[model samples]
Target: MNRLDNPILQVLESYKAAVWAKDVNALVALYDRDAVVFDMWGTWSYNGIASWRAMVEGWFGSLGTERVIVDFSEARTIVAADLAVVHAFATYKAVDADGLELRAMDNRLTMTLRQQADGWNIVHQHTSSPIEAGTAQVIFRR
Candidate 1:
């Protein structure tokens, strides 16, 4: 199937749109009710949809006057009959209400999705960034 017609890609597009809008409900709707997430910041892991939703809410809430723009590159997806795994390098840029860039960071993202009756739902997600050997600080650039 063409990339443009891939359901997995559609999910990613939806995710980008949701994040850009800071729509917490729309963002969490992409995941399964029992999803697990290992986010790169703030906490070790989120155990379920509720936990993940809380984190997303906090994140969107904290933005206040800023909105995040998400971009994905080098995305690779493997799909079986009912399961799929996708990994990509994701960049997030925070922009002011006027759309001026504030700051940006890059991270690695991986998600495992299951085909549900309605559509593909992310069952597991993990995001991380490399640490510099000397400074032990996160490397946010490609």
Candidate 2:
């Protein structure tokens, strides 16, 4: 991919594609060996290849096989020579485990990536749902 194409953005898009396909192996491949993923499930705040794979496995049962359509906005990638930070709004479509179309969720996601010998790999990712509109006050629930 062209560096001008925004490496971090590219990786984020690839991740969405992989998740949509429920291809766990491909999903894990996008992360560095020492990456961290934080989402609704709480702080998977520290993770690596093994934990990443395990997290993917955990989501396997929740797989709905529904096509995911992502609407991304407010995307900004701050790039250096070998490091970058990405932030964006993602609106997603997918069926829930109950087989009902999930209420569309607008999430704000931030990621940190490193350009390693193997190419751009995510070193950290944090995601949270939108509160109202463009606010970051996450309302966590069980």
Candidate 3:
């Protein structure tokens, strides 16, 4: 099926909406109860929804609305039976109230989803930003 028409693709749209709206409640609702996340900044991936909630809440609390902007592009999805994988390049920016950009990062993201009775539920997510070759520093997609 085309990506746009796929109900599975709603997972990403919901994610974009939740992040842009900075609504943690909305964010977790898209995930499976036991989802794991390969986050950009952390000792390791989050174990489940509870851990995920704490981290996301911290992020929204710290950044608020003015600082965080997220955009996703080049999204593609593959579905087979009860499994689905959606991936895209995401650009996110953090700006101060003065409109000064503190940081910006573009990263590739992949989410693994399972078709449940309700809908597709995200079970795992992995995100990685390209490193600058010259400086050997990560762009810090968070």
Candidate 4:
């Protein structure tokens, strides 16, 4: 099957766009109502879309007037009719309104999507970034 036709792969475009736009509603719509997420900044894993909203909101809130750019790399999707698993490396760069990058991070990402009547919805997602063992410094870029 053509990868372009995969619902999980197709939804990623929407995800990327929503994140860049900082549209919490749009981002939440991409997840199942009962979706669970393990976000990089969240101290604990979020259980359900309701809980995930806070994380999404916090990200956008912290930006103030700044904008963020998101990129995904080395992404691969495996599908079995009703379910799809995707893994990738994701990068987030926060830039000032004037177009200066304030900070950036490269993270490991995994998302599981379920094909529903509407399309594929992310049921579970996990995001993480490694830290240096010696200095306890986060490895922001790869």
Candidate 5:
């Protein structure tokens, strides 16, 4: 079956929607209360939902008059009973209030989720980009 057809992957859709709208509450709702996140920017790690929410708030707040569009490609998922792991190439495009694209970046994203009473909730999330071998600068695009 296609990965998109799987119910467990629905969180990804919610994630994209939340980010595009800069809806911090909806985005944080996709994670477990005890979720842990290793974001690609700024901090090294976020230990729980409270910490993750703060990061999300700051990210959306920093956008100002710009909005971010998030897209996921080359997504793959493995499901084993009540646990699932998903990895994908994620692209983020920044657009102005008028919808003109300003900048974009791509990164690798991996999320581990657990099937809960409500639905799949991410327990852990990690996002990263490759580094230049010599300069140690991040490679935003493949």
Candidate 6:
């Protein structure tokens, strides 16, 4: 494994650990100093390390005994000279404080990583729900 590989895996593994451990500081550690995180459901964009740190803090506060289990699959990594992209499919199941299942959703995630002086940190991320296979080929009704 290359030095870059360690951090790449660490960042992703940290994400999984953070969800399970509900550790906000651990999650923030995976991001770059100027990273930006955007969720499809919200207009709020978390920018900069501090802002992203705060965002994770909020999630930790809100969890309130809720737990998340992430099933990650089909992970493929592409490495360039100094950057890498990891593409994977994921299913997340959230259970509330009472251990009742809240929701289960599937999405595809692309994490773009860059090598920095400190380590390999996620610079950008894009995630989208699985699209229907034939949805793109719309046929107008006669």
TM-score of 6: 0.77
Residues 16-43, candidate 4, lDDT per residue (tens digit)? 8898899999989999999988877736
Put down candidate 2 lDDT per residue, 1-142, tens digits, no spaces. Answer: 4434766777877877787778888889998988888876655465778887887877765654555555667888888999988888877767655556665667778888899998899898898864545665664321
Question: Could you say which candidate leads in lDDT?
Answer: 1
Candidate 3 TM-score, true structure as reference: 0.85
Taking the tens digit of each residue's C-alpha lDDT, what string does model 6 give over 1-142?
6423666655666688777788787778788888876654464576788877776777778777788876667777887877998887767778887768887777778888898888778888776664447776322111
The C-alpha TM-scores of every prediction are 0.96, 0.76, 0.85, 0.91, 0.96, 0.77
Which residue pairs show backbone clashes in model 3? none
Question: What lDDT score belongs to each candidate, Candidate 1 first?
Answer: 0.94, 0.75, 0.85, 0.86, 0.92, 0.73
| Clash counts for the predictions, in order | 0, 0, 0, 0, 0, 0
lDDT of 5 by residue, 1-142 (tens): 6646887667888999999889999999999999999998879999999999999999999999999998889888999999999999999999998999999999999999999998999999999999999999999987
Q: Once superposed on the true structure, which residue ranges of model 4 sit more than 4 Å away at CA? A: 1-5
Question: How high a TM-score does candidate 4 get?
Answer: 0.91
Residue 30 miss distance in model 4 (angstroms): 0.8
Query: Candidate 3 on 107-134: residue-level lDDT in tens?
Result: 8899999999989999999988888899
Task: Flag regions of model 1 displaced more than 4 Å.
Answer: 1-3
lDDT head-to-head 1 vs 2, winner: 1
Ranking by lDDT: 1, 5, 4, 3, 2, 6
Report clash pairs, candidate 1: none
Clashes of 1: 0
Model 3, which residues run further than 4 Å from truth? 1-4, 65-67, 95-102, 140-142
Overlapping backbone residue pairs in candidate 6 total 0
